[model samples]
Target chain A: MFERVLIVEDHESVSNSVKQALNDLGVDNPEHVSYCDYALSWIKKAIVTPQPYDLLITDLSFEEDQTVQQITDGVALIRAVREVQPDLKILVFTAEGRLEVIRPLIEKLGINAYVRKARRDTQELKAAFEAIANGRNYFPLQMKRSERNGHSFNFSTYDITIIRLLAEGKKQKDIPQCLQDNKITPSSLSSLEKRLNQIKDEFSFTTNEQLIAYCKDFKII
Target chain B: MFERVLIVEDHESVSNSVKQALNDLGVDNPEHVSYCDYALSWIKKAIVTPQPYDLLITDLSFEEDQTVQQITDGVALIRAVREVQPDLKILVFTAEGRLEVIRPLIEKLGINAYVRKARRDTQELKAAFEAIANGRNYFPLQMKRSERNGHSFNFSTYDITIIRLLAEGKKQKDIPQCLQDNKITPSSLSSLEKRLNQIKDEFSFTTNEQLIAYCKDFKII
Candidate 1:
């Protein structure tokens, strides 16, 4: 019954297509914000607005420097919106499929629905909207079978500590000192940097700077 | 507030302790079932009886044997229960921290709550029970940050093929031939074994056989 929808996505073409699709679904007053700040402003005004968006479809990734806070990623954006409007339904649309990466926020942030961005089918989003519209839930079906089976990743908590430090603009050589300062020296972090490099390669990046910049931009730091 | 809880956990001590903790929280009927079958039986019986258990606190690792149709290892259990009693609250007590692994179920399954197992405090189980009692959600606060930044480890279609061939007791030399036969070459599999070894070490295993055995046991194969 909720017709108004708001979308928080960085991809302009994709966002427009989704907006048009919702229009086809008879949803009017659908607003698309390309960044979290704009979406937050809309949500802040939603309390007094005559017509507040009933549904939200957001993407996890955002354009760099467009995000305000170091932690103001799309997931963070969703968390903020949840605080403002606990009753509003949200559906996440993302292409990132790492089961290990987003495991914790699924429950922690109180997301209403999730749709993996599929190139072949719009049915995933369609199904998600239908489920939430009926006051039911929608998520991937294979999660129960896969469970936590492959959810573990190579980077330990120490790696995150180092990555966060690096994102703070510390030098590559100073990383070892940083790890030592934090009292988390499993190995001399020259070795840790080596490990970090390995992680970056796994995700397909060549250098520490690129990885650090990527993490900072994504607010992983 | 509902008191009776069914615990579907594979680990013996964890299963026992969780039940004990629930009992300590003043829930008299905290039923604990280790295998998925036992858990399923209780769910089925509860459906017919109507005086069903109020909650399911499941470990994400429980898998039915190789032959059984893997309906819902962990999520399926909750789904099965929800199929019968759509309102029953479920709390996932898990070590899994991946987006793909956790996102779909939390959004789709209508899980009442979750408590990250690794961050289990001295009174964490009691806290989880109490949260459920109050009709509120309880997921760990810190889990979201680490889980988001964590690199998602996905075994590629090629990775799956290699692991499967390894599981079938094929020797190391057979991998290149196997890949060649399949019209794909993964360069040298010597490094493949090294990566597999690293994976095995992370998951706590000794040999390829041990890794294969774990796969069989965990239903990852």
Candidate 2:
């Protein structure tokens, strides 16, 4: 059902293979580019065209080149493109399989799918495309568990603000004053202590430092 | 003081620039290669030669190619080279700047220095080489603090073995029995508890989970 797609990959062999796979999946004229700058330009071009690209499949890391570039990595490119077209469906293709590293991108960027580059990954890629076309998010089963657990526990604005401040090296005693200055609700020292303790208990964390590290790993802060 | 050094980097531009930097530092005959396999073979040749390479500089990630390789990443190459030449000094030059990732290479593999690939990194690389030549280990100042704190506390065999088991997903209650079966000393329940508590207190950790994560970050286990 997909009409248009754009692939951003630095490796020539990888880009060609991905293009071939897209062809076999019945998507014709699937455009590809090796640089983030060119990919951005293509996205911009599609925005004013009669029929815009429906999906963007991109690699995360790009090798360096002689020509200077404003966008060096895919994350920065995603941020830039999102500013121009917020509703574009995105699928990330990367060799980086670390959950902690990629979780923040999915949560913050609202990317539609992530397909790891591995053996039999082409099948996984096709499945991801179909899922995205059906308006559903797709992640590997192992990562699905982490995604569910990450989202199951809801974090309030107050919790996020407190964690962010803690990560910035703010002292517990000084946090109440900082929160009050920002007009954050329930800024009392006792209230803050209770909230932190509750969060620690929920996560089975025994100390504030552990809570901070856990929040960092999950990209909650 | 360095006579011969080998550079292992995949990117031609990066390899050339690093080679230029080495030349500037008055180190002639500085050889460079784009693959880990070539680097390993060169090390083996040097090992049998009358004059062996005095230092090794390697990047962690190499771009994947159509031609499959026996040794793909730099870490595996480091391990292989270390096995053959235990006394060889190694300097890791990588874009991977995270302390959690690089700390293990320093503590477990005994790498001489780590230089992040960033602005003015050529100067940093030169400094790393000089420091290693002077019989000193060089890590960024931020990492130096953690390294000092990590080394300040002494870990006994009992402490390490317990933490290693815990990291392997062993429950606290099940640990004493496991250790006893292995004929480890201080296998009493009370002694195990005391040792764990002492370790936690030393690191200001409040739970066994926190202790395990901390040990993992510092590569203590």
Candidate 3:
């Protein structure tokens, strides 16, 4: 179980409820911050010290106050925090219910759990904590539905770069030269072809255009 | 035609090529900057002056240097520029080819044109300028193909909010009350149902879950 947790949320009521939830889940010594900047500073300091936070529970959006914040949003905060502490488990608690927004937080950003702010969000928070404590990534029911529909593919940065190039109107044969010029590794034709074919097979796509279309539709590239 | 254009690109070669392309298009006086902060400062200055730049052409990503920049990326720059000069047209010239990433810039961020930096990118740049000059939003061929596949939708902020709430685990019956609590307008159940139906019909979605799944997959929400 996570003995120490840090909650980053702007709403006072929500933050209090999260603390109560964590208390009920038997996790004590949970700290909270109202601003992303403050939270980030705390995390950075914790990183330098021996007792770093066991888990970071953060909200994606924060209400802008009069003072200008260095890190305005949770995405930037997460990226910065990840850079400092790569192994830290992150559980995002946000009112932003869009999968388009949160998918990257999970897939690309490597968040451990996501608990949406809704009617029974406290319950979900508890579940999220339990899941994270057990070293499992918790996906809400909606995200599970996305996975069932084949929208959940483990995409490497290498794969994304290749697909993005293709979408930029690069022909298959010419990709090697483009990659070589860009100094991207595995620029050989055989590797490119094999990788593209593998992606096509995974998605049941017939052509590069279709693959591009699918990627665009899903915002994959 | 735009007489004055501001180009924001970190790459020296790409910036030079873009300048040449603009010159070839018979549009002289295209100013270039390597840093987003410098580009934003120029834009801010132009806003108060009489001879404001007609169009802004920017790359999405900027290389980080030794000195920390206030406006680190092109998205932040575009947002700041849009706030100051709402009428100034924006044409994104970037190697970023992911529709998922750039679609928001077109639909939400209000960028007028996109020119992918690939083979014959200079030609595309000229075409983008021509489209913008003619008061048309230039959709790259890949983007056009996405629209053909029914990926394009005119999603209002309200619609996105509603769908996002649903994706966040809010029941249809509970949404109106939740929205009402948040002081959001059109909080009646009938309106919410009608809006959801319209969106489902637009995407041929049989259920709210499917709609959410589609939104997640396409990064629409």
lDDT of each: 0.66, 0.78, 0.78
What DockQ, on C-alphas, does every prediction get?
0.01, 0.06, 0.02
* Per-residue accuracy of model 3 over B152-192 as CA lDDT, tens digit each: 57788898888777655566788899899889999999999
Worst 10 residues of 3 chain B by lDDT: B143-152
Q: TM-score for every candidate vs. truth? A: 0.41, 0.47, 0.37
- Evaluated with TM-score, which candidate comes out highest? 2
Kindly list the per-residue Cα lDDT of model 1 for residues B1-221, writing each as its tens digit.
66567888755435545655666677787787766667878887876675877788886765444545445478767777777778778888765665556777778887866665542332665776688789887765655665655545555676667767764546667678878887865647776777777776676554454444434433355
lDDT of model 1, residue B15: 58
lDDT for residue B139 in candidate 2, whole number 0-100: 88
Candidate 2 chain A weakest lDDT stretch, 10 residues: A144-153
- Supply the TM-score for candidate 1: 0.41
List the candidates ranked by lDDT, beginning with the highest.
Answer: 2, 3, 1
Candidate 3 residues lying further than 4 Å off, grouped into runs, are: A1-221, B1-5, B10-37, B46-55, B60-90, B94-114, B117-119, B127-146, B151-154, B169-174, B185-198, B201-207
